[model samples]
Target: MELKGIHHVSAITANAAGNFEFYTKTLGMRLIKKTVNQDDVSVYHLFYGDDIGTPGTELTFFELPRAARTHEGNNSISEISLRTASDAALEYWKKRFQEENVEHGEIEIRYNRKALPFRDFEGQRLVLISEENENGESGTPWKKSPVPAEFSILGLGPVYLTVPDLEPTHKVLTDLLGFRREGSYLSKNYGQSEIVVYASGKGGPGTEIHLEERKDLQRERLGRGGVHHVAFRTADQAELQEWIKKIENTNFINSGLVDRYYFKSLYFREPNGILFELATDGPGFTADEDLSQLGESLALPPFLEQRRSEIEGKLKPLETKVKEQ
Candidate 1:
């Protein structure tokens, strides 16, 4: 079963409004959707990405305002990467961060890729990598943000995962899924060798998956400030079902077809203890809301319509506004 690429990456954040400001104003991604978490209506499930909020372009967050800070450890996702047009775009980002007084680390090279690492308002580590090998769907420009037409984000870059042992995780990524070993490196921070995996073709945004081996580091707890799950894309429902069978046959428990409103999802955890999802690509976020008013209001799945008023009252109000640097 061949996988197309990443569908979306979800994480937990501390403040919804702060995250909104950072992602939309600081990072220049469009606030594509503002909704509530299906399971927990008290929290906001905010999504930020390219215009039109394409499937693979989404970076979602669950806001838990009072949650405690989580320590970054071996069993957690280390960083989220976004791909830009070139190294020159990264330079532009550096200048933008400086102008905003947001402290960013120096640009670094890993696994032969150039990346600039920075943090959001909630301390979620994010990287901007300049790689143009993979083709991206063209979308409308986010006119409100500082991002210009040419250098806007292509989409999500490699989702970084860490584990205690590298072999089992590597096997799941290469054998079960179709990612190939791109390169390996010794981390200056963790001081252990990390292997980076990329899709079969020359990888770009949402293609590379980084795995770090840290035997001594403790396992991480999933809560605020942690990645929820990493989803890989499939061409359609048939392909998704095929991979579902493939994953179930491998002795992993996979959730059967789940209607995510826009896309269908099948979820399973890999051998390395990382949660992975296989998602379909059609029936997107615009299925209900018109493209013009997509992220401006609370959008819910059809089944939840009867409870809309209660859900809306439970969630905190989040207003989207452009902030000056």
Candidate 2:
């Protein structure tokens, strides 16, 4: 049994309203779920993806109001990558970012794939990579997105991790998690450091992890715009249980079998202290809301339904009305 590609990446956002506007309006990703953070009922946990919130396509953010900016450094999930359909799409986004005044870099080749690095309003580091010759799961684009379907963000690409030492992290990824070392590339930012490539299920942009060993920087002070965790995809609850057993068998302590309501999960920190989650792909966002009206209103899991009134009272209203093109 092996993990699928990336399940989702959950990051932190300071302003829910601005996050909503940027992701849904500027980036053209559909806000698939409008919900509260289950652990802390007061804050919002917003989910964005393709037309429907597909497993690999999901990008979530936990709103931490008035949080400090991320102190960028090593031992962190450095950058998140979004997949587009082609090199032509890269050109489209380049022009689009210029027109929208979005902070971005010129299109460049990353591990042989054309990539355009950009930042969100929160200074969240994200790169758009062309999936021209890439394989694995390609997420469906929202038909109604302001960005044309041909050039819209498809799904997650390789997640980049910055660590001081790669040995322990490499062991955890290879021996524990079954990711194989594919190859390496010279670091774009740090010329002295080499970025290693590891692929899990089916080797491709979606299934890969680009690890950079950066001993030069301090440990990241995670805050707003920082990635909380990156979850790799598993098949279902049964498969997730097997993974839990495997994780428990190892020396690493883990959050065993967390029932996330939408999908079951197992959370554990790798050797470098970066949070890694193993999550199921089924019982998705559709479990609570209809496909047509997802993210249109506040959604509560069945377990949290009784506290809806209390939850709603705590959250500051951020309009999530569905606007079709």
Candidate 3:
């Protein structure tokens, strides 16, 4: 079965306060969930997205205070491209970045679309792609966002990956994941590397995954200021089960059927060592809190509910609300 699109792209950010300011005030995404990492209760897990934190619109960050820096290399998610409506929207973001003093690159073309690439304070590369024609994926905008409704970001677009060897991971994307190869383009920023673009679902930013082969570079280190994993969307549990068997026959391995409170998940590492997850989108953020109060307080899964006081004591409080500019 064909997957719908991206579930979420999770990453690590060293500076929690800086990330809060940048993602909320500057970028204008809603802080949909404020919780601690399930595996590590001491660390904060912050989720940012469109008004309601839709699956494709999500980008999550695990805060690691004083953690070692990671070296960017192969088998890493180098860039997270988000979707905006039009050329004017992309242009509006360029001016907004400059006004906010966020460092950004010049506008560039990729696969006949205009893109504005920029990096967060912690050096996570990001791009805002123009998806004016793909209106179906355009999400509801935050009314209070510094960015206007028409110009706000839609959702996750191209999750650019750097792989040491393309063949191994390419199979996982195509044969197992059901993404068809779209075409290729040479990206000047990544050592003039030829980027292969694969797509699934209907044509839009969220459906595209871009790969840049970098066999010469070393395996990337997992640390602060780097992508943690890429989660692809599965329509339901039945689809997730079918994928487990498909992955079992291949050289790759997966952690099967993890009940992750909001949604079920299956974690697998592609041949190149990048973590990829197939997640079912259901019982979403609204499961715990009303939509209006999302991210307003620390939300724990049923298992962690009793340890709320202890967990709260260990982690620093995240400033979820932003005063509109």
Clashes of each: 0, 0, 0
Model 2 lDDT per residue over 1-325, tens place: 9998899999999999999999988989999999999899999999999998888999999999978999999899999999999999999999999999999999998899899999999899999999898766788888778889999998899999999998999999999999999999886667757899999897789888999888789999999999999999999989889999899998888999888898999999998999999999989999988999889899999999999999999999999986656
Q: Considering summed lDDT, which 10 consecutive residues are worst modelled in model 1? A: 132-141
TM of each candidate vs. truth: 0.92, 0.99, 0.96
Q: Which has the better TM-score: candidate 2, or candidate 3?
A: 2
- Highest TM-score: which candidate? 2
Worst 10 residues of 3 by lDDT: 316-325
| lDDT value for model 1 | 0.78
**What range of 10 consecutive residues in model 2 has the weakest lDDT sum?**
185-194
Better of 1 and 2 by TM-score: 2
Candidate 1 per-residue lDDT, tens place, 1-325, comes to 5676678899999889888888887778888878778778778888887878776788999888887776778766778888787788888888888888776788888666678888766677788887744364433556665788677876788888888888888888898888888766767666656565666333555666888788888887676667888888888898888887787788888888888787899988887678898888878888888876768888888988888998888877887644443
| Total clashes in model 3, counting residue pairs 3 or more apart in sequence or in different chains | 0
**Count of backbone collisions within predicted model 1:** 0
Cα RMSDs, all models: 2.4, 0.8, 1.5
Q: Order the candidates by lDDT, highest first — what do you get?
A: 2, 3, 1
